[model samples]
Target: MRKLVCVAAMLSLGVTQVTFSADLAGAKDHPLVSRFRGADAVGYGQADFGNARLPSGANGKHTDAAGRLTDIVYRAPPGKRAAEVFENYRQALAGAGFAISWQCGPGTRDDGCGGFRFAGDLADPVIATLKGDSSEMIKLLDATNNNVSYLIATLVKNGQTSTVALMVSQDDERPTGVLLRVIDAAPMAQGQVTVDAAAMAKGLAAEGKITLYGLHFATDSATLTPDSKQTLDEMAKALKAAPALKVYIVGHTDNTGALAHNEKLSQDRAAAVVKALTTTYGIAANRLAAKGLASYSPVAANTSEPGKAKNRRVEMVAQ
Candidate 1:
């Protein structure tokens, strides 16, 4: 027969068995500190360049210039002390051309450095992780002096600035933990409304409401950007073309803070737009009603940057 019997190799008396090692839990490290070892990753995330607030000095905070952010949380190998991990990271950062900005550690008064106050949907998970059965770890958090250690450093490379925060703490039981947040300042989403007044009018005429994208604003503020002039002029033209048309100006925001805060911000922004249309564009104040919808009426999902951008907008609704 064409098929022959296959013989399997017999085990030798002196043969050794080969085994492969498994990766440690959360072992991945960010590229900035890939050389340092001993900790396993427990959490990781990234966002396109955005503002980061870092502890400045005692009882103060500094806002980093906009940049990409890479956040990582790691659990230290057993027997690794918090102080040891902090010092090691400090040295490593310095060696990598980073200048120390601020540091808080044991023996320092509680100044609220290195602690994070998460907002919006991100709060529950972060709070649970920080507060769960780990009294020692909680005490070691930024702003507490229960043996917590944290460092902030700045690095400038290729005409771009980057900031890093390394906070370390110990758990009550086995493994210690470290939170590493890095922000690399880089170009991000451009704030400019490209849609003209005709398009806005057409959309409103057909859909009863039109979302405006070109109304730019400063971060966390209602002040309109100078570049918003084009969009504003177009909106004015549309209002002039339909003198009898009354519309409701609605402002919206992304889900990034407490519901109340976001609602108030949206209201303020809507009022600002109404004021601009009246004073700057000569649109009659009575023809426009301002309202803030906050994040309740979203046109897209809130899980991604594009969705968040879409949600942060102003709409003209025919009344």
Candidate 2:
């Protein structure tokens, strides 16, 4: 009888050890974020504070001010479809005071908007890291790789605007995946410290170089924002006041991503600034040379958000 009982106990242990569910071990939702009902977190990461570029509309992006950035990946409960998962989160976000900025899904009215294409790019790293050796799971993710449904939303709470990007996809394996990214936009930086034409002239005369912090550009793009007009105008005025003052318009960036990419991006931005000064502000094009030094001469350490912000600026050096 004792031998029979021992065999039964061993059988019970084998039954209890059966594995199920694909959620990543020890994954959990962030404090400032939440997962959809019946969904389990499969991956997560966060930066204490950073900037996030949120999709504004079709083919458009906007940079949120410095704040905490959080990313979470979730697996939907069995029997749920990707579209349904997206809708559930959309409704939940709306209920939580988030205004939908944009939304798209497979076969939906906005199906061809390229939102899903962007989502696939955003999900690549997360899935690669968390899916591991599960070839079936990888294939499942790739099946809907181009059919992802997504939503971008914003909410203002506690005097801060928070941006959210949510994406969902599913495959024949019956498991849906959702990726959530949130950026808590901090208050806009204080008014830009402007160097007037007089200050620029003095600096050029004495130090042969002047740094300007007022110029602004869209995140990861050469396009100047509207608020950059005043700064460009000042620069043009200084150049016009001294017709013989040839200078180099140097662009600098923070060491955030790939060095090569940053070098190219900075060069493009400097060239754009030169074009704006000449064409829009009526400064002579021959008087300015555009150069990108990348992150070689950072004014501060790149270990913190404020330092990174300071490193991304345009400067003028006498030539």
Candidate 3:
């Protein structure tokens, strides 16, 4: 069950469907630093963190019912120094089998970068432990309204892992270190699970005006799971709510299938999604464009089943 949930999330990441063009090794620093500069600073901690400090937060949103925050955080200074911290964190967590989910805050939503929103759905607790000596799992609690973000790095080791989430607020404004407080108190879910849409798009918006819909899926398969449809429905509401903005439907997949097959699948699925939007949901097709990617690009790994799942996915890029 744990493996299935992990596979589902990896599939949601789009590892099985599309490929990437740019090598994202150095894309983490600037965007994260920028986000740190823009948020409200509640407290400051030592810039140099050799040891992991547990964070705490209220259980209402950023935590589970038991009040534990299950997210992983890595702090670094601005500029190259921060990247070094990121690298160290990457190595440590990767040594344990995790994949970093590269993310950026709202201020840096350029092409190829994941925009900031809530850390709600991105947080996946250990549904079931597999091939590990440790039973402890990592999760990012709710930061729906707290506007700080960074280049999030997730890791998966032997089907058991934690994410190395890196964030930098604009001007280096940091949040209260309440993440650990919640983690210590969170009650475990009963089974291996995938994050849902409410958690994924809690605070997401488009063009600083329209609220964006985040519909994520695994690569290759165009079948919209219940979670994927929920996310799309949320966006559909946003489209209905704000009728002026146009959206581009971007389709992506992992590096597993043949390039031609991947491109076709991405295109067909994207067009299908647009079709659903226009014909079924009443959104205009003119508001959408289908872009297909063959398996040359990736935000995670193509080596493992979980990583490949993360690689295959579709996203709505802003117009």
Candidate 4:
């Protein structure tokens, strides 16, 4: 079993980037005010709580600029409290006209993990809302990689509203990671979280079990055949109908190659299915987990070519 790494230190980097429909010209302003152009003429004020290293040479330096109510950059070191950093920014923005409409950070779960091993603390994203009642919702974006963090706040004053955001990031050369964006919790005029409940029902139909079918592979290799696309198409249909339903996509192999190699090949095949689902069908990043089972979980005999073909398959178990 792959032991879970300690992630307590990841709490310090809790925040993600906020992208606009168009790049805001005043994004670098001291207080960071952004305007949604054209018919979307609404302007927003922002605050970033990411523990990213800024030019301050220390943590919690507040600077004032045009459009920015207050800009505070905090570089919290290991063994330090990020709440202290957030308090400083709170004070600065308070001096201005903004008050905390919402705030979010790592929870008790992040306490014992120690320090972060990845960037952005990207795995943990929390949203606090002052709806009719004050409530907080925390979401995890990626499980395999848990180093990214982000937070977003929406403050309202009379008829005007502004949004503040912060994100901490670390460099990972490969573009395979999770990203979270917080949407304001407003009463829906129609839909329930824009979720198609019927679709969700279809997705839950195959919750924990994986099914199989016979398919040929390349000689001496685990590479899938062109005919395998038919099975993949069925999997894609199930995913598309229920967009929010996430699954643990697994690949299994027959006992032909060495166990280690078979395991690796199975894992690769599983991930390939995930890529096709996400990129080709526009599935969200947080909804897929990929793994390889090797030949240990085979359902058929390796004695016959027909039986072995039945053992090589891609299986999905809803997470």
Error of 3 at 216 (Å): 7.4
lDDT of 4 by residue, 1-319 (tens): 1111111111122333334343233322222232111111112233321111211111223211112132212222233233333344444444445444433333222321223322223222122211111110122222223333333344444444444444332222322111222222221121112223344345458446455342335654555566656555666666777777778877888898699888888888777777766786677768899889988887867764444655776667788
Model 4 regions more than 4 Å off: 1-207, 212-225
Q: lDDT tens string, model 3, 1-319?
A: 0010122233222244221122122112110111122122121122111212211121212211222223222222224233333334334434434444443332321211233233323322221211111111221123333433444333333443333334422222322211111112122321133334343233335223222224443434665545556556666775676577676666777776688888888787777778778887899878778777756557666654444555666666556
Better of 1 and 4 by TM-score: 1
The TM-score of predicted model 3 comes to: 0.36
What's each prediction's TM-score? 0.49, 0.48, 0.36, 0.33
lDDT of 2 by residue, 163-231 (tens): 788777676565887777877765337235778889999998999899888888888998988888778
Alpha-carbon RMSD, candidate 1:
16.2
Clashing pairs in 1: 26-41, 49-67, 49-68, 67-185, 193-214
Worst 10-residue lDDT window, candidate 4:
129-138
TM-score, model 1 to reference: 0.49
**Model 1: per-residue Cα lDDT at residue 263:** 93
| Backbone clashes in model 2 | 0
